[model samples]
Target: MRGQEMEHVLEAEGLGKRYGARWALRDCALRLPTGRIAALVGPNGSGKTTLLHLAVGLLRPDAGAVRVFGETPYENTTALADIGFVAQNTPVYRDFTADELVRMGGKVNRRWDATLARTRLAQAGIPPHTPAGKLSGGQRAQVALALALAKRPRLLLLDEPVASLDPLARREFLQSLMGSVAESGTTVLLSSHILADLERSCDFLVVLQAGQVHLTGAVEDIVAAHQQLVGPRHHGEPIDGVATVVRARHTDRQSTLVVRTDGPVTDPAWTVHELSLEDLILAYLAGSDTQSNHEAWGVAA
Candidate 1:
């Protein structure tokens, strides 16, 4: 599946990583199909960055495996050529101008698309000779993205590329990214803490919690399968053959639940409603199996 352009672009099974006795990622598994803009989300210590590093071959797994285009990417130049990564704070060579950076990329990557790089930067109004360090946060990020995209990578890995920008800058960065990917049909895996921004851009979801993947699927399927119910307060009971509660909370007179439903909710006692992508992501993250995560990561139960 990973070999074909129309199939899964990235695949991982039982992927894991560690720091001393702490497991940064544990038994992580997911498949990213081609041309999907997938969001990878989790709280601060849940291994989001670790997972991206592993996929891009910046770090090797301590156990299990990860494959990009069906090859282990650690030092695999051929596979690495097809993947591009932009890290947190949009790190770039501060001393290098956008033009210089493009030249550097052309020298290093065999498939570099210099025209695409120059065109994108020009459209974004980036000064060609300004050192990237002196450019605004948004411009520097745009330059980094252009460099990555100009390589014509099949899969792009972005790790919180807009986390530091102001709201307008953030929006512009995303718009530029979406525009380029749309034009090129590049598969994207983006990790960021801004859920609202993700909802607007990503169509697939990967939620991690306490160092393990808690959910993964197309965004629409996930939002549709999960429903919210509100009704008279009661012990959270399983709605057999109908819904499995993912999260629940109650007041004295009401119980509210988010459940994975099998069909139309027929129970007259409950009021069913749909969840937004942000709400659904929050529910799964809040309701994830932390006890198991504790065991997997060597934390006390």
Candidate 2:
């Protein structure tokens, strides 16, 4: 696992979890490649945490299986050792100090890197003696990062690690995390609502909507091929030459669309424009809504 090219440090197949009348995640299949940073983006209640919990084995799926390094992770200490997860909010023992947490990692984890933890803390300007409860949200986030890194896990899973930090702190934390990934070649899966941050730091992305994957691909490929099209009034002409229409808006005199393309543009009346990451994500989210509405109205003609 250490030397070989692991196709996926983590993988899921037909994964799902149900809570009576509702699903937190449904048939969620994921394949996270090694040595890359992936951001999981979704709206609130969109099963981001559910998918992560299943991936880390905090929660078991009812319908399918999750594999971390080709083995089930639920109670397998060996499998767990290769994975480090920081929950959506920062996790700290209120009475403990940063140094104490590092010591605990040394005691409990087989691959602890105490020196790295201390060095990271020093570099982040986090005081070793400060109690967990006394640190600000941002400093606490740094401590959490240090603790997770100290384990020296091959894969790091972060759930909204910077959700509570200030803007400046969030930027600093992401920069530090990016640096760690660059230095260690560690695979990272961080979930966030901030598309801008994800666009900057993640090489890959998973977009979730209504408990399912709306899209998954390399960030560059997704952005490079999708186009926004605006055209003069066309009453009923269908757009061609794109794999999918992610968004379309009409205002009587003109029509605009966001389409996923893989070939040269051919339509004469439409203006094709490259889409930003934000445009791509918003289009996907909007697509989910349109699909649901179509289903409700039985309008697929």
Candidate 3:
């Protein structure tokens, strides 16, 4: 598709990155729409952070291109102005107080909204006089979020933003992020290892496995297209019309499989069960396990 005709807020086409001979990301493609939260999910080595860094202009792709708001993100001042990024390790002055941090935002970013920063800090019960380094990990995360929101950005790119928080704090942080998106129509792309967090907070999901995109779409649509099937064991014939057998299990009399099928099940011999977000996530992580005597497959997109 032509760049000007695309409606995506963020676009990546055949993106790849490598360090020496080790591949960090490969064949990555995304067309993210506006005003929605997208979860960049994967296992530890699956390149979520690499994709995010490229999207935010902190890193460049070796083989492809990324565009944000119809323009290249790297070194594009106007595009950068519209993006707010909170890296895994937030950029903060350890010795600075909340008040000083707010002031720093004013002096640095052209789009800074001092009022929003202050209001968020106040709501979180974070004292302006507290030194940034002295705050708890959760508190520090909140402060970083406040600063990011202070820019009033059109898009927010967060890389493992809640990694260090406790359950309660993580909940609060996610709530805050969702609230901000609802209030301002911000487009958010966040990466997280926590499946439950993404399931609850994001409407759109992307699953990356071994540097390739396994699936990407609305959460509801993905759930609807996948199912767990249970039936008696069989020999070498492929399932009649199933999309892809994601995983399989067997007892002496029965064989059960998780499959991503087009539409739904109609056969009487097999029973279909809806998959949870967590189940879907695990299916992707297991990634075509061949050791099982049963067949596990992935349909090509």
Candidate 4:
């Protein structure tokens, strides 16, 4: 609407999805800039999968809209072709060999990179002749990654790609993902239920709760903006425009709060403590009272 529109690979506004009477995702807005691995973290039923599905055009939104690579991907074959998606459980043809999967991928995507796919699997020691169903979970996951990466997609979407992996396998998958991303500079939206894995690999952060985006920003900025302030209960906390309380616990004598603050804390009675990425995420997930806080613990409606 103004100067050049932001260079976002994925942009969604007022995005919503529903199933019968239940809203799977409601009034969501997100902008994923180029080349950032934005972690889409939420609990098991927190609409993470729903949002990913909407993005890849697997499921149409019931309200609002989503665009990929500057075009809505739903039924847009050309748009989907420029994107790579690794679904949950890393599903590949159970009956197809690793090599066959590669060949199939080459035919499906207009821009094929058979060498890249084969070379990646070959380097990972995945036997091309073996059927994918016979491979170990980690090996299968690697083959899935290889397939997605070989698409040379500008944007890659991964939905809980490591949920079923052991610790070692998860680490290996994430490492492979990061290395390939660094090499290709592909913008990625990786959804997960675990914070530790996302923290290690993702620079951008998004927190979703009950089908709404509770918070989104740079990981460091988010961690830096939130703090736990402990002070006298009678003094009252500074919760206004600059300080919005995300969570608070008050005793007769003292009040402890985790707040997203943008200004200096001048109250001498309060002791400020920094929040870890995990702590910050948990606070928002557990926060309450929609009408009370205006500055924090919220995203655009």
Better of 1 and 2 by lDDT: 1
Candidate 4 ranges with C-alpha deviation above 4 Å:
1-3, 234-242, 288-301
Q: Write the per-residue lDDT of candidate 2 for residues 258-290, one digit (tens) a residue.
A: 888868678898998888898799888877654
Candidate topping lDDT: 1
Per-residue lDDT of model 3, residues 1-301, tens digit only: 6555445799889989998897899988898988789999998878998988888888878888888987888777788888888998665798999989999989988889999999999999898998999988888888999998999988999989898889999999999989988999999999999999999999899998878888999888888888888887845357655888777777888887878887557778888788998898888788554454343444433
| TM-scores for the candidates | 0.93, 0.93, 0.92, 0.91
Residues 1-301 of candidate 4: C-alpha lDDT, one tens digit per residue: 5224447888889999999999989999998888898999887788999999888889898999999877888888888987899999999999999999999998888888999999989888999999999999999999999999988998999999999999998998899889989998999999998888888899898888889988988898888888888877844434543368888788998888888888877667778898888878877877744554444657542
lDDT of 3: 0.86
Give per-model CA RMSD.
Answer: 3.3, 3.3, 4.8, 5.5
Pairs in clash, predicted candidate 1: none
What count of clashes does model 1 give? 0
Measured with C-alpha atoms, the lDDT of residue 163 in candidate 1 is 85
Model 1 C-alpha lDDT versus the unseen true structure: 0.90
| Collision count for each candidate, in order | 0, 0, 0, 0
In model 2, which regions exceed 4 Å deviation?
1-5, 233-238, 290-301
Residue-level lDDT of model 1, residues 1-301, one tens digit each, is: 4246348888899999999999999999989999999999998889999999999999999989999888898888998999999988888899999999999999999999999999999999999998999999989989989988988999999999998889998999999999989988999999998999999999999999988998899998998898888888969566643567888888989988888988888878988888998998888888865687689999898
Residue 41 shift from truth in candidate 1, angstroms: 1.0
Q: Model 4: which residue pairs collide?
A: none
